[model samples]
Target: MPADENTAAEATEARRGRGGRGERGGAAARRAARSGGGPGQQLTYVTRKLPVYEVLGEEGIALIEANADTVLEEVGIEFRGDAEALALWKEAGAEVKGERIHFPKGLCRSLLSTAPSIFTQHARNPERSVQIGGDATVFAPVYGPPFVRDLDGNRRYATVEDFRNFVKLAYMAPNIHHSGGTVCEPVDVPVNKRHLDMVYAHMRFSDKPFMGSVTAPERAEDTVAMAKILFGEDFVDQNTVIISLINANSPMVFDETMLGAAKVYARHNQATIITPFILAGAMSPVTVAGTLTQVLAEVLAGAAFTQLVRPGAPVVFGTFASSISMQSGAPTFGTPEPSLVSYGAAQLARRLGLPFRTGGSLTASKVSDAQAAYESANTLNSTMLAGTNFVLHAAGWLEGGLVSSYEKFMMDVDQLGMQQRIAEGVDLSENGQAMDAIREVGPGSHYLGCAHTQANFQTAFYRSAIADNNSYEQWSSEGEKAAHQRAGQLARQWLDTYQAPALDEAIDEALKDFVARKKDSMPDAFS
Candidate 1:
């Protein structure tokens, strides 16, 4: 056998040997502790033990930073529609030319100094709260998909029911750490009023941390009001109970809609993830280096704006980098260049002393097929290895993010469990050493029946919930099923068995009343 395989076999054996008949009860207890005594009992997030894969050297990073500073100083960024934002920039020594704000060198960085490097987003269930920075990595489900592929393989516009279902699935998923915002856009609900239902669904169906609506400034205000209802006003005021996404219009622009929402969240002491939604060759330069410079410039300006709203607010440096097919003008995922961008961008975020968000199980495939699997894996793996702190769209993405697939969600969740294990790195404990088992088994003899093996076999390896490893004859006897088919079955089973975490009666009633009054106050506008 090759050395690496041989080493892996030995490590597996050692891990298995760490337990024995005497340790069985302790092993079970340990398992319970790790799993937080079953789902929904205690919320948990991954703290990576593996070293981050850094593709850029110090010189490369310096070059990118210098270029980004030049872009900010020379070209400047346009702040359209928000005069208040422009005024603040001018007040802070930036040269405001019409709507464009020319930031002096080191201005954004100085402004970001007050932003917290790490902060906790308090879930209604305190045990479900997550740390969002440093070594921690939190996984949130797919966000903002307008369509969904149901269990039967039919794709259709997502409704509020579909939205709630995705929230429930995220809650039940052992690997999903956050109940993501806008899991899929509920087109059935009026555009003006859907945020109410979406926020309420996350509050009602799941106890995990969730994102706030940023569609409009008033909608963001509504989200804060509702959050105050769920979590007390004082708690909401003093703590970060919500984290919202604020995307910059790529190529050096920050629209008023995003700016307004960002100000609302920042002023309320909530978190704002400033992401540059860049599609290379369209929104950004085709070269990875060029893209990195632009991403850094955009993130710096947006994140700095949050600090300007409130000095000590929490903010995340986020980027969504993907390439476009030059010939077809369609976005591409899981490519090498995007991975490089992710790695480089992560380094930049770290250098700025802020939490970073990037990467997801992204794919352009319309269905959960081999193409989807390969593309999603490429992006997902890079996301983890790049040391991403907060991950949005960690699962269920398909059709270049236009649709969320039920089967793909489950498959991605299974892969997420693997990522969790990878983040745990290697166990160097005495049990993991397995010296006693090795001594007993000696050379050539198998240790399968040994006491340690017998005791630890159940938990020694990450048993995939989706992959089928059964023999061909057994597989044929049961009806051969593709991965998507198996995943679809799992999704159905989870939804069937899902039991929502309890909420206080008063809080639930208040949330419902708030939604009703808000809806009644506004006439439904589909657009």
Candidate 2:
């Protein structure tokens, strides 16, 4: 081994030795528990035991709903560049003026009645399937970042290898339940054909439920066909195997691309998350209430369109709300205004009886520094308390969603493990009372040596994988590495140790064949 590698190994061994038997045992116990039931055994998704925090009272919620209705009835939302969508609206009793569809007072809500309040998105490995509504909180990795900050802290355009590495990282993370779509845009692949590689990475590298391509209608169709080949045609048609994102162009418009993708997913009995991408001052009103109203209005139109395509189809009411810096005209994240918007939007989704999707570890910092930590914590806390059902961008976001940092990804994964612990709430069982421990260890004596303490010590607290809790002397003696440095080391270790889940040979061959045939059918389009 190299000198540096030998030094790192020696330091790690020294730390383990100094941690004592209890800490070493705890770490071993956690590892054993994770691997006990084979893959997908470590908690599939979080079911929150704590009550959801609500910011809007009855009157406040009613006011926002009324304003959203007025926006739909008066201003109307445009279904741009898709005459088929306009025709669907017209046929469904919505008044079509050009490409804009003016809905009646209760049209969208009534149409959404057929949508399920909760549904399961089936993974190729059934054990990894996730419940995406109600008390469930499913964490997926970051999506749509064009660049990556590598282990050496250099930023560059993301490639297909980076995409697959992210998939492997997400699969290895116990708290990230879903393998996200477009973890980062692979610039090395053709824009028109990259979805094939991206989707294939998700299927081949992970067994978790994943999002689908929605960049174009045909790409969405290709996703469905590939899913059919993997899961079988009849099974794919009968169940919700793939869930995709369909973003409504903010300020009340559903562009042709999103509209077309949504229709394709809906018609095939798949799931779609109808999100309105909003920036408080630019795409929406600056005020929280105004932003909530616009978000509801946009989600209503987009989700209602899914039901129109196929009644009883699953859909998630999603919002991506941020505020922009007034001076620079750049997007800002982890701000108070967007947090308020998330809270209000959650209440709105509940009132409409739909699954809500929002919030993540969002930040605008160029690297995984103090600023990134603070911003990501703020947003993640709000996301948990606000009752977000399906959290996209739950990890690895940086530089205003432009770059995915490897160190930040591991840091966020550690935080997500903490969130999982928080969601468990307090335990009031007899064992949790600890009266026996108090009795055994009398006043003035510590419980560290008590029987109860020994029995429960291993799982008593959440241990952060990226945090260094050793003495200052010990830290300095090792290397005095910063948190990001430690996180980078851990990320490298995980990638080195990652093992792709078992996949059937026939299914794998079929998926590859489908991808090859589809790529051959179309000329590559970079734009």
Candidate 3:
């Protein structure tokens, strides 16, 4: 094709890509750019504009902190089979009794002072860099689900293709800030080598900041190496590029794998979210206070250990505790107990002065039904009010996190935009006051034809992409599709129309070659 014809086609595609879900991050710059509208054009990062709602009073906070200290000193926590970690604990002035390390009253808290309260997680595209901690809340999609569901209502094991599609959808969803780690577990890919593919997909498809692998110590190392290739090793060492998740085994246990991964990330000054996986009544005591004590102790141990690995290493104090159904022994979602735990955990994290990570749009419904909507709404509200800094599973989570629904992904993305609007709070600026418009339209006159109303019409009201606001007769005339169905349509349309952010050819080739070499060196192990 001729140069002119090719440019015309590119412009057409760019136009078709416009007018997506919500206001993009850099819309004016996107329109002025000569190149095609790429993912880099719009990076929607949410900064919390609302005040935090504290659930625990000062006395409650003091009591919890005191109890947490007692648990650490008297009860102690176990570092199973991690001789190196135990040795480090011993060197850090903790009393080491075999694998169990007992801290003195304020030992862990003293060590936590080394971790930075806030840091930037850089993306391949610098515009998409995210500030973790303080007043920012970065929204990431559903992570680590082994199964996937499509628009056809089919449920099955996720494939590499499905994983790539999810990446594309995440890239397309402007509301999602980070391309999270393991958007879905690609079952078709060998267990030993999926991280390579996952990281490569994130690097290639999206320009957003993404999570690093923590499945194994070596996997975390591979993630760093790949990041070095994308963003030079010197840049990566000085700047926090990837934030990895390190889970602690509940009931006061720190597994070797999570510790090893944290060690690797901390060694390079990368950020790690030291999280405690708690299920009340099962992994923890049924009461919120008991669970809060355990959550604090576990994070203090894991996060403090990261500081031991490298002082001033960036780490997020994370909480993922939920209640369980006693009757069926099943995990519940969007319940009161989890909200209380999340709120209290946020207060505890603030008290310790560390960045916090929690869940979003959490639900246990098998499909994207009424239960999914209400549950997700409740979860999102609690997370926002709790002032979360990094939100994982912000969208598409379903069936107690066993599956990621395509429709729900879109639905939750829309809701996330709504949350961002809500967090912005009511504007009080002169323009926002609308006094002139009110005076101009006073005395039996409508504001619809006023200049202020016309001026602010585009942005004055929150526009929903998947919501149906038509009359009942008009909705029935248009087939009366439900919210989930409309979301499915938007999901499919986004996938079909998705254009991956352009990467330099040399860098893209180098990343692919590196992934291939790493995969070839590993044996296929499915366990």
Candidate 4:
């Protein structure tokens, strides 16, 4: 079912602080606070232990140092963005060819030394959840790919209405915590105004921490400015509310826009997540080692910029990357390379003492199908096992993350629950409820009528939603629809029925004025 009434009511209760058992009193809160999970970051599966790294143990540090040397020497990265980066690398005993710069082994070691392992992402909505250090996972809204299926089912280019509607849908979503939106369809906001809309969408629809989609240099500056304005001047400088994610163009490139954005965040000691999306056998070499060499080079290059721009910037070594398909020659989302890369990334990120951003629910298919489930589940499993600190696309991605499908959105929520169950790891700390209940009636005991079952049932075991636990006859009669159908329906209903939180009159007016001024300056973008 598409977010049944119980789910809706549960959501309501959660908003009002009543439904779940998340609340904690004095000692528990203090203990939880003392935990390295961080005040802003809460692990959904707190009891579930991820495989921790021994970065400085034995020869691990030496291994990382060796790897850095290899990356800079043999697996050297080439940059094709600003001449400044090239000049810097060339001065550091590197090669310079036009805009492309080959990083030296010494530079890589120096750069890698400055990165960190765990950091926090604070939300604008104090009530909303933030994540870091593999403690919690994040679900981002769909983006990029153009075109939509109209009411009559004809595929056509998307418009501003489509963007706004998608934005509205993202804003209305119950489980998703961040709104990755400019939400203005193909109407196309000017490169700069896109940042404004993204910031504005977060301002209007969510109090949650949102991603700033700054596609270029000027836009990145605008984005940082907006954050400083929305929050206090010291806010972005302090890694609160807004955290900037900069993707280094793979196969040796650091566009000015990305480098510029990294500069802003790094200068402020705010968060900067450097990622690379490489299409294997295409943009990257076909072989895994070749891909890693190229990817590691990009990482080091970004690390160099980050440290050079400002030392000690709160940076995340994100492996939000995927490989390409050899057959179709397009990017492949659901594949083994992402998992492998994510694992290696986690190991490397740990060495930096920085949090890792890994993959999740990524797929090549456009809609929520059986293909979607298989791919997403496998990806999630791999990332979680890899001890990834932060998970992107944890929930709600469909049509290869190009188009948002509500059906898949809610299903992802359910999938998250399932994954959390894995982390729950049998719950041996359930006060021995299972055995006690079993012993309550001896070997032949019937616990169904026992007080243990009556009182501690909810905490005693694993539960499933997408999977049927009912009798086979009942399941057969119900006519099973894949989780996608259920998710799609939920997305539609959320768009149609869910209401956004009220905004302050003054803030709303200011936002409207901001949009108007921007729109006037960039009419070409107000699609």
Candidate lDDT (C-alpha), each = 0.89, 0.88, 0.85, 0.59
Sequence-dependent TM-score of model 4: 0.79
Give me candidate 1's TM-score against the actual structure.
0.93
Model 2 per-residue lDDT tens digits across residues 1-527: 23542343344332222111111244565653432211233566989999999999999999999999999999999999998899889999999999989999999999999999998787776657788899999999999999999999899999999999999989877788999899999999999899999999988888788889999999999999988876767667867889999998999999999999999999999999999999889999989999999999999999999999999999999999999999988999888999999999999999999999999999999999999999999999999999999999999999999998889998998888888888989999989998999888998999889999888766677767778899999999989999999999988987887777767677778889988988899898889
Candidate with better TM-score, 2 vs 3: 2
Tens digits of lDDT, candidate 4, 285-326: 776556655666677678767777676676777666676667
- Residue 433 in candidate 1 has what lDDT? 91
TM per candidate comes to 0.93, 0.93, 0.93, 0.79
Q: Positional deviation of 35 in candidate 3, in angstroms?
A: 25
Model 2 accuracy (lDDT, Cα):
0.88
Tell me how far the alpha carbon of residue 2 in candidate 4 is from the true structure, in angstroms, after superposition. 40
Clash count, predicted structure 1 = 0
Better of 3 and 4 by lDDT: 3
Clashes of 4: 17
- Candidate 3 runs further than 4 Å off: 1-43
